[model samples]
Structure formats: structure tokens, C-alpha cells
Target: MLAIPVLAAVITIAWAADADIYLESIDKKFFNSLNKIESIFKTWFPKFSFSTEYHIENYQINSLNNESYGLLYSGGLDSLSSYIKHKKETLSLISIWGADIPLNKTKFWDKVKYKVTQLAEMDDIKCYFIKTNVREMMNENLLNKTYLEGEDTNWWLSVSHGLILTSLTSLLPIKTLIMPSSMDENEKVPHGSDLFKFMDYRWADSSLIYDCNLSRHEKIKYLLRGNTQYYQFLRVCYTQFQDYNCGMCEKCLRTITGLLIEGIDPNKCNFKVKNGFLDLIKYYLSNNIILLHSEIAAWEDIQNNIPEESSIEFSFGLKNLILMIIIIKRTIKKEYF
Candidate 1:
């Protein structure tokens, strides 16, 4: 396993004062901290260098500025499509991986690593691979009741990445942190919403951090626009490894369903399960009741009209009863597995 030297202590001590102060008081200190991080990166990855011509801009932590664009790249289909779509305006790509997990253990880490390396080779953009001690960070912050809730692991993780990027921005001449989250991801019950909201809320609450922005719908539209080749490389499943996606997972089911709705065949991807199509149908039937209600509510709000019979409501009521019976049976048998 490759590891960067312990620069965390140096960063903590050097930026103690800046970290203590609210976002407003730490411009110079933040810049200094960023310089240190960049220096460490230069030592660790000598081939990588910051762009000489770029210029840095300062702002209140909550303010959105052009210089604030950095992508929380995950090497997934959504992120990859968004990145390719906005390649021209993007300043940098940032990825965070838990040091304990190893790339092979994580579902999409290898794919992401490969794509980022490819993108870095293009010379049009800069990619930063941030290794995080996630367990350590969680442990250190766990005493705080907010962190204990674990309401949004994704957002919390992103904020952790954001902090690193913000520190990097402090050193580099870039503004605007561009994250490619989606509207679907933001919707209730969707994957990683807790984490996304956590990062957004924390950044917004901070008096020191400024100009954080997320491009959800815009990125979606960009991907929807003729990016067929780019779409082929997207990986969304949380299971399976090395050229195959476990289609039964929540992510795989949703991706395939959406593609089908858009008239695309889910089986054509580089990764997929043998029974992906049937799995998607079965999952939809099992989960559709609640999902339909949520979708209907959203659609109703947009249309400003009621459905003739509220199919979602009827379906949910029926499905809830069935699910409850299943849970009861499992509890009775002590066969939770």
C-alpha cells in the first residue's frame, strides 16, 4: 500500500489559528495551509505540479464564485459524464478514498483511478487523488453528537473531501468547487442524500468557508445531451468487481431502470449482471409502491394538479402491509439472514 508521509500534524499546528477563526479571518492562513498541502503533494507525487498561470480568488465560505469549481469525482457514470460534459470549465478533479478500504475492496475505485489517470494525461485538467483516514476522522469527530447521527455519510465524506480541496484551493489559484451530484441523488430516500445535505448544510453554516456550489441538474442535462460514448463507461453498482456490475444493488437497479425509461438497453454496458433485466423488474415491483408515491408527489407539485386516483397512494398502502407481514415472519423465525 502506498502512503503519504505524516503531514497532518504539521498542517494542524501551522493552521491552528486559522482553523480556530471563522471563514473570514483565515484567508491568508488558509492560503498558507493550502501551500503546505500542495508542497506535500509535490514531494509525494513529483510528476504533478500546479498550473502557473491560474489565479486565486478569495470569498466568504458560503459564497459561490467562478474559482470555487472543483468536482467531487467518484469515477461513476454520473460523475464521468458530468466531467466530460464540463471539461472546458472545470478547474480540478478531486477523489477521496478511505485508506483502510483499498481500491479493490471498494466497488468503483479502480474504474475511477483509471479514468482519472486517463483524464490527467489529456493536459486539459488536473486530477488530485486524496487518501483519507476516514475511520480516524470519524473516530476523532464521533464525540460530537452531530457526527454520531450518521445522517449523511456521503455528505460528511464529501465535506471531508471539500476541506482538503478548500485547503488546496487556498494554495492554488482556483475558485469554484464543482461537485457532480444529481437531482435524483438529492431526492428523499435516494443514495447518499444524507451525506450531500450534510456537506451542503455545513458549508452554508460556516462563516469562513465560501463559494461552495453543486451542479446537479446542469450535469444531468449535460450527460443527457449526446454523450453516448461517455455514457458507455459509467459504473454505478455497489457490488461486483473487475468488469462486472451486480445488477441487483439499489444503484444498478435504478441506473438500468432509468436507461430503460430513456429507451436504452441496460445490458449493453461494460458491466452488468446475468439476470440484470429480471432483477430490475423484480426490485421495482418490490420497491415501487413507496417510490411511486414519492414520484407522484413530485410530479403533482410540478404539474400543480392531482392524479385521477393517486395510484401511488393505493400501491403504497398495499405494499406496506405485505412488507410488514414479511418482517413479522422473519422476526418470528429468528432467521434475519
Candidate 2:
């Protein structure tokens, strides 16, 4: 259990640096799955592709202790949708401060704690808080300085988050671990979370399931359709600038656009949408200042939700934003994917 997560925390770094992985003992299932997952990533992200040998002293076989569903919850829409989708079987909800809030951000974790506590208490679910510095297990500055070639590159987004977050659940006994899909199945971007499916169905006796059947916008629509009050606890922001969804980041803006497309005021969903915020998005896109790596596919999901004939706020801003994302991808960021 200890060695598996530690290996996950560093495996991508090893792959990127072409360094070999040496482990004392690893679950044979996970080791085998890593090879397949690595191959898939090589096809998805060829720029960082590198092969490495795995030296394991012992390959142990493990089995599930019980039948229970667990989810990697972040109080975000994706996890919220996953929770609602499997709420009947989901007995355990796992949230790690290290993954997003960071170990030292006690204040931020308090906001997360309040929301998750309220959510679990309302749903009669078990919530576990794993506080660690696992996300800080690597020197990200050094990783980027060595690897980033003057473009946007996030260590957590493109490489280390999915496996490391899922592996932390090993500390608890779970039958199946559910990781929220960050993109639609049709999206072709190379994301670290996209590899979760290859790691599915086996890890010792526990299974890792990443569901991509529903797009992000579709998840929002599902949440609305379920008519559950649990959606009130959504926390979609990863930045340190706010208590919840900072409605200006590219992620928050995209999510805000999705919510607006569904006719819900973002303020009702843990985000503060100030006046003229839609114009701000237009300004950034018009000036070619993309707020983040711009998950073009996610933006495309929002685009698809808007009808071609409807000339609403989301329809117009999303139109130009998608164009900018496409232009950036084709001209500037094509080589990375």
C-alpha cells in the first residue's frame, strides 16, 4: 500500500525524465496496468514519451475486502455528478487537501471541510479527509524548469494527479475507486486523468473506474435534472484567490458558461459572477490572452450546448472563445498534442 502510492507519485516524473522505477514491492496488477497506461499516454502525448524499466523485488497479489464504492471528491461538479450517479452504492467519499488545497492552506481546507461535511451529513455518507504533502512530493519548479519549453505546462494537470490521488485511497479498504472524468470520451487532448481507464478494473483486488460517458456540460445538466440540493456545495476553483469558484479563471469561466447555458445563475452555484464578466472573457479572447491551457474540448462541450441560432451571452462569448482555442491549438500548441 505504501509503496504503490509512492511509486505513483513519481512514475510520471520517471517517464518524463527517462528514469527507471525501482520498487520494493508492488501489486502485480497495478504494475501490468502501468505498462498499458504508459503506451496509451505515449500515443496521446508523444512530446514527453520515454520508456523506462520497472524493477520490482516482489509482485504481490491482493484482493478486495468488501463491496463498496469510493470516489475522489473535490467538491467540484465532476465529483458531485459522480457522487450523484453512484450515490446509492457510494459509501465512501475521499477528499485530499494535498491534491488541491495544499497542506498549509488550513483556511482553504476549512471551506472544503464545511462543504464536504455538510454534503456527507446530508446524504448519510462517510467522508474521509486525508491530509498530506503528497502533491509536494516532487520539486515542480525544477520539473517545469527542466521540461517546460516556454509554453503552458502544469505538472498536476498533464502528469501526476490522477494516479497519485487514486493511490491515496489504498489507505482505506475499497472495492472500487471512482475517479471523475475530466473530459468527454471524444476529446483527444492528452490529460493525465485520461489514463485512468487503463488503470481501471484492477489494482490488487480494488478497481479504478473513470467514467467519460457524460461530458462536463452533460454532468451539469444531470445535476440540474436530479433536482438535488447537493449541487449547492460545488467548489470548482483550484486557485488561491477565493473561498470557492473564482469566476474569472478559465476553468471557472468555462463552468460558469456551462451553468449559464443551462439557465442557472452562477451565484447560486458557489460562484460570484460580477457584472460585465462575460465581456471580460471576450476581452481576454479578443486580445489572445487565454487564462490557462484552455481545455479546448471542454470549451467545445459548452459550445455544443449553445444552439447556433440563439444569440445569448454564452452563445456569443463561447463562439469567439472556441475560435481562439482552435486557433491557439492549431498554430501554437499543436506540437504538444
* Candidate number of the best lDDT: 2
Q: In candidate 2, what are the lDDT values of residues 94-124, reduced to their tens digit?
A: 9888877877778888888888989899989
Tens-digit lDDT string for candidate 1 (23-130):
222243334434544444333222222332213334333332334356656666556765775677755777666532344455556665776667666546777776
Clashing pairs in 2: none
lDDT of 1: 0.42
- The top-ranked prediction according to TM-score is 2
Q: Which 10 consecutive residues of model 2 have the lowest summed lDDT?
A: 328-337
What is the lDDT of every predicted structure here? 0.42, 0.72
Q: What's model 1's lDDT at 134? A: 43
For model 1, the stretches where C-alpha displacement exceeds 4 angstroms are: 1-69, 99-111, 120-124, 140-173, 184-222, 239-244, 267-269, 273-276, 287-337
TM-scores of the models, in the given order? 0.50, 0.82
Off by over 4 Å in 2: 44-53, 145-152, 185-188, 198-201, 225-228, 291-293, 307-337
